[model samples]
Target: MVTLRNAGLSLTPRNIDTQSLSLISWNTDGFSSRPVSRASLILDHILEGPKSPDIIFLQEVTPFVRAFLLKDARVRAAFLATDAEDQTGLFEDVPFLTMTLVSSERFADSLHSQKQGQGVQGGEDCMLGRVARVTLPSKYKRDALCVDVVSPTAPGAFFRLINVHLDSLGDTLHYRAQQIEILANVLHEPGCSGGIIAGDFNAISPEDDGLIDKNGLVDA
Candidate 1:
């Protein structure tokens, strides 16, 4: 496992030219209610760059925003969690649409799945979203969407991307520690490879007195 240290490195962007693929990850903080607009802005930023990324890992995005992106032809693929509280089944529709666009031609064997548990009081909503290959992997498989992303340019190289958003409220120190533990275990599991654990950690600073120590995380 690779640990990104908070210090000892200059703040310039690392040169990724030698890398076959680049993955972008971020937490959208969906509950804020501006997901649609925020998504648009993010897309703009990504596109503004000279190069496009091969994969994007986003957390805390609502079903509504995912659906909106799927409607656009430019979105090559998407994997998101279903809001459990959406008993009307409206939440599942977005992924279904995205699959129609990406599954056949591009991410032919991609998969998707959601973490168990409802976000809201009703079963209609869920807090954590995950999506993996439509087909399952041979090892270390779970309900979470765990898939291998093979770079088109580099056949033998691959990585695992785990998107997460830990508990944001209550005893933050305790919660962050638990999150680090969970992430470490997941990464250590069999068949796991080098990957980034990206999401809303809610920890503002590395020295924030309350931060927990796990492995491989760099506070920035």
Candidate 2:
């Protein structure tokens, strides 16, 4: 299968009058194998521009990245749902897809709560008034962080933010479909206003249609 080998940055923006609420999704590959640490590079890319996304959804967070986030004063102030503080697993590889959620300092107060996902899927739900994460199912332990957030761009409305990282094996598509089914149930939670699911799904083909519309989900 032709999985998403490299990485991607997906941003969804909504306009409310003159303001906009934008959410960013990215897979960092843990920066495990690299010549130079690219954490700062990614951070600069996210923070340099005025039109930066208000929230960031990250995947494959590593211990090194976690340390940097803890040490950096700016990142510390940004308010995040990272495993930087989690030491439950002493092993080097805590979890392959330890998803993290980040929000601009300006909206620090906007964060409501962070909770783990259902069953054995060790993911999180970063709650932001209008948009919130509900639940998920990842058989291979491919974690996803769900968010309940109020789109700043759409003042009075709410939506869900799902930061997902699916299995990369050959049989990934099958499991991905199952994950989507669980996601459908997640989207039905009371305050959900139709949200976006972004991440590295490890899709097999470029022409592959998600068939998500049947579940009230469409590719963004």
Candidate 3:
């Protein structure tokens, strides 16, 4: 089970002053699960260095890898949305486990899974997907994770951070459309004033209009 702490993250506002908060996302290619030389690249570039990003979004994180990242003190908050749980870690399904997100101010505040259905898993689900969301398709359980934070830049002002991992290698155009619809819905929900949505988008730009123009979010 995932947990949430009552702590708050202090952030730098993009207005008035230079933004202290920065975001970085990467596809580890199963770094945490494999735990090897490539993993060291992450360590050397981000985790071990002093100039680390304030917010981190990682993709292709295996359950084992996410579990390992959770233990590190640098992760301020983690929103890990995974495919269906597999406690055994015996099956190494690549598409079955295409994406997940983790956040850290270098410790943890809270972590939560973003919704699917209107959302996208990697792609397998998209290929066998709904006809106008009537009946759900077979799912690989990909996810979008959301995190909330209050910034020192504007104390008491709250904002949301969203991490996404889209379909890897399938009928991405249609699949991304459906997924963006769900993502747009999440952004438009009441009390959702503003937020950052970042991750692996397998599709091209035209498909992003709904998530942008329709939803009132401009590219950052």
RMSD for each of the candidates: 11.2, 6.8, 11.3
Task: Candidate 3: list runs displaced more than 4 Å.
Answer: 1-19, 31-36, 71-139, 151-157, 204-211
Model 1: per-residue Cα lDDT over 149-168, one tens digit each: 44433333444555444444
The runs of at least 3 residues in candidate 2 whose Cα sits more than 4 Å from the true structure, single-residue gaps closed, are 1-19, 82-94, 104-106, 110-139, 151-157, 206-208
Q: List the residue pairs that clash in candidate 3.
A: 74-106, 75-107, 76-104, 76-105, 76-106, 76-107, 76-108, 77-103, 122-167
Tens-digit per-residue lDDT, 1-220, candidate 2: 0112233434333322233345666666764575127766776787688654555666676666756655767666665554445445623434555444555443454332333431111112222553233334455566556655554445455556677776666656667777767776666666455656677666665423553665566554
TM-scores, one per candidate: 0.56, 0.69, 0.57
Could you tell me which 10 consecutive residues in candidate 1 have the lowest summed lDDT?
118-127
Residue 67 accuracy (lDDT) in model 2: 65
Best by TM-score: 2
lDDT (0-100) at residue 51 of candidate 2? 55
Better of 1 and 3 by lDDT: 3
Order of candidate numbers by TM-score, starting with the best: 2, 3, 1
The per-model lDDT (C-alpha) reads 0.42, 0.53, 0.45
